[model samples]
Target: MTATLPRVDTAPAAAVKRRRRSLGWVAVVPLLAFTAVAFGLPAWAVLDGAFTDKGTGAYTTANLTASLQGAYLTALVGSVKLSAVSAALATLLGLPLAQAVVTSRHRALREAVLTASGVLANFGGVPLAFAFVATLGNAGVLTRHLDLTDKGWDLYSFWGLVVVYLYFLIPLMVLTITPALEGLRVQWREAAQNNGATTAQYWLHVALPVLLPTLLGGFVLLFGSAFAAYATAAAIVGSSVPLITLQIADALSGNVLVGQENVALALSLDMVLVAGLVMAVYLPLQRRSARWLA
Candidate 1:
């Protein structure tokens, strides 16, 4: 009664590992170059310009100081308010939509919604603003037919801008939250059911807790998206809305307020700070969600 031990080959695996390690830089170099050219240079330019004087190129804090005052300050506040409202609305609406898509029995419906979301999420800027204006603006098709203007529906105002933002923000939220929703395991539901938990109880206690981190992360993501939206808002409302992006454009192009390149860069610096804060919150939340989801 003898037992035999099987032999395993190591040379092929070792050679493959060595080959992969050697070839790894093939991908790394291009990515590094792209990052340097695309992100690094732009970031350096902003940092350099933010403190430098437009006339002498000498270092000063006047631009940054000016950016935090008067109309520029108002623009910053308006931008934050808009971003928060849009992101909040998007997160609330998109969660249920994502849930519906996830829980649906029909594969075709799920596929269609997901496909539509992917397209619509990235479908912002001029064309989208134009479409909305054509459909809802004064003298627009819907406006002419329904007389929405008389009924106090102004499509070029603040609330109107929020509505337009919702168009893309909701879709972006759907795409962002869908994966997190899918990460909700069936076994967890079954376990809760076995413990005599109702559907509501199961969700409220188990599901919501697990999904909270993801929800927060998604909110942060949506916030960043809405905060950075410039072209769409510009096309629809222009300088009518007191948004930081518009303010920056105005200053850079010498349209109004503080018309200076350094001031524009300083405003951009403020934007970078806001984005940094968002990333700071988002990264931790993502890590937490990953642990639970995994």
Candidate 2:
């Protein structure tokens, strides 16, 4: 009770906040710089080159118009169809696999499945193409043994590309949807059962609604992955399949046509636009999923 206490200082709190803010900026600096150097610069270049004449340095829409005509249009359609089919198949196959992994009793089995999925999801490009070729191509070991050619199997065709795509796509979906599957609460199922709801009814009325957003998001991701794929298709089938990515490469290298570098940029821009539209749909679904899962 005795004396005048020294005035408590409040400046320390402000100083701490300032230090934290500085640290936050410091942490983000590298990321910002990397983005500017890598993604931002390249994206800007593509946008610029797409809208400008290379020789005349004049603004034009000719390149974009050219991208939408003839074989380029066919390539776009083929790419979209391929991506859609692969994403759909991967979603259909992966949902069951993810459910099984989530519901498994053994921890080791769950861990192993998840580990394999993580590795396989990233295991694309040349090596993956080569593996498929060795296993299923015309002169492949399995091909010779199984006589798949006579049975109407071709590893260098559109369906064959679909088959190859599913190898990585399914694992990606598994990795993506497993968390959503795990987010399913036991209490929900228990409550449904207690209320005399059949398993089918529970899934149809309750679980599907909860999982729908995440499922769509996963599908969109898989579609984008398939749409942008290049190396694997290039290695496996060359230019046999007229995919948009292959067309873009062709335009860039002046292989199919000269003086079409701007058209290549235009195609790249189209890809970006498509990807943007996909993300626009996916973002809302992702947020909705988080509302339930979180």
Candidate 3:
């Protein structure tokens, strides 16, 4: 005795598909409009200006060439190095903390930790700078309490800048890495242990491969943040450090730099360089991410 075949219901399925397709545009249109206005226009302006000669309709490389001066080059190099180092430090510091939080049984504690991290991550610019200054500056609490003439701690130095940068970077790393670590499967660890794999071997073979892409992506984002950082460095060091952002601001003010037009051109060139670097990293990362998802 053969079983009867199940009835097919194509009409309802098609109707549901059509309904979803119809409603999709309602969400799509507004998002498209907002993106075009807010992001598209500004990006177009920047790109256009990068290629165009302000004085002449014909294009010129003079602006770009001039921006590649020793001082500007040094600033760019310093910024990239600082960002990379800071992000690396954050990753090293945050990874274990993320693993601990994800493996924790205490839900309340996890939430509390995450909340605190979120607050700190959002605390950039003047407030964060001021906080660091208050803690470690000349008249700061730490300075007043601990006096050591031999071991000098200056917030104006490159290392001091990095310290402040790490304060912000660490929180960002915690926020980014927590989700990636949480996504890791638990059985893998037990399975590795069963196979006589050491903790380092297990992580090196399994966990690290999965985590690397996300870590790299997070690092790029952190680098962008550090590179674009203006307020924090400005507030703490008061243009004494002479970062790219501070230089740009000075140029924009039209009072400090020798030539206002040249300064503007230089800033535009810096903007282009930053944009190019971001795109260079982001495009490959996006493709790599897609492969991981697949």
Candidate 4:
């Protein structure tokens, strides 16, 4: 027994395993640290400030209550309305465009469209607002040439803002839906054809059913993007558009109300709630979509 024990030394192997485990934990530390600093800390600040009264430093629900009343409520409604409209239009427009690109005979065309979508999807805020304003503003070249002002084309109005939003939202939808479209297995279509299903029948029965979740997910994604937009709307419509984001900025800057910074935080909290609801719906649909697309 003593000779057997002497021959079975495993200390070095155990030490190596322990060292690898330590390294694994060490690798994870930086990421955890970054998350805490970037998201966790800022979130805590918002929550704390949202609940506290600036004057007495006492926690209260008045700010939250106030966010749901009067102009604040209107702003929230406006934001929701704009986001829904833009997302719906973008989904309708982009799905077919993406389908066309995906089914295109020319590989170069597909590549060009996809490349353009990737770039345009990310192109927004000040520069985009500037471009639209220059091209569609009251004295803009197109506005002057086409007499769009006479046709009721006000670039700073609700419909105009919707049009501006669509510029980026459409590209975003194209980028999002293309992958799901590509994941449509060829065998499924062939199987449907062998069963004597026409193109419309195949899509109505099979393709649309499989893609419904992905479509809904894309809509939610676009909705969130439009809802959170600040800079572009700020640059274009300014206070003319009463978005929740604009309300938040106003509160923070005392542009509309002084000593209302906590109320702004509360509005931000409301936004967080809305975003949470969006994520709640989107995540489940996205997971279902992944099961099919994978």
Q: In TM-score terms, which candidate is top?
A: 2
Question: Candidate 1 lDDT (Cα, whole model)?
Answer: 0.94
lDDT of 1 by residue, 1-294 (tens): 889889899999999999999799776999999999999999999999999998887999999999999999999999999999989999999999999999999999999999999999899999999999999999789999998999999999999999999999899999888888899999999999999999999989999999999999999998999999999999999988899999999888887644487899999999999999999999999999999888
Rank the candidate models, highest TM-score first: 2, 4, 1, 3
Model 3 C-alpha lDDT per residue in residues 128-222, reported as the tens digit of each score: 88888888887778877886223788877677888998887888888987877876777888999999999999899998887888778778777
* lDDT winner between candidates 1 and 4: 4
Question: For model 4, how many clashes?
Answer: 0
How displaced is residue 134 in candidate 1, in Å? 0.9
**TM-score of each predicted structure versus truth:** 0.90, 0.94, 0.82, 0.94
In the range 1-294, model 2's lDDT, one tens digit per residue, is 789989989899999999999999999999999999999999999999999997899999998998899999999999999999999999999999999999999999999999999999999999999999999999999999999999999999999999999999999999999999999999999999999999999999999999999999999999999999999999988888889999999999999778889999999999999999999999999999999998
lDDT of each: 0.94, 0.95, 0.76, 0.96
Find the 10 residues in a row with the least total lDDT in model 2: 251-260
User: Could you give the candidate ranking by lDDT, starting with the highest?
Assistant: 4, 2, 1, 3
Error at 270, model 3, angstroms:
3.6
Candidate 2 Cα errors over 4 Å, as ranges: 1-12
* Weakest ten-residue segment in model 3 by summed lDDT: 257-266
Highest-scoring model, lDDT: 4
Error of 1 at 277 (Å): 1.0
Model 2, residue 142: C-alpha shift (Å): 1.8
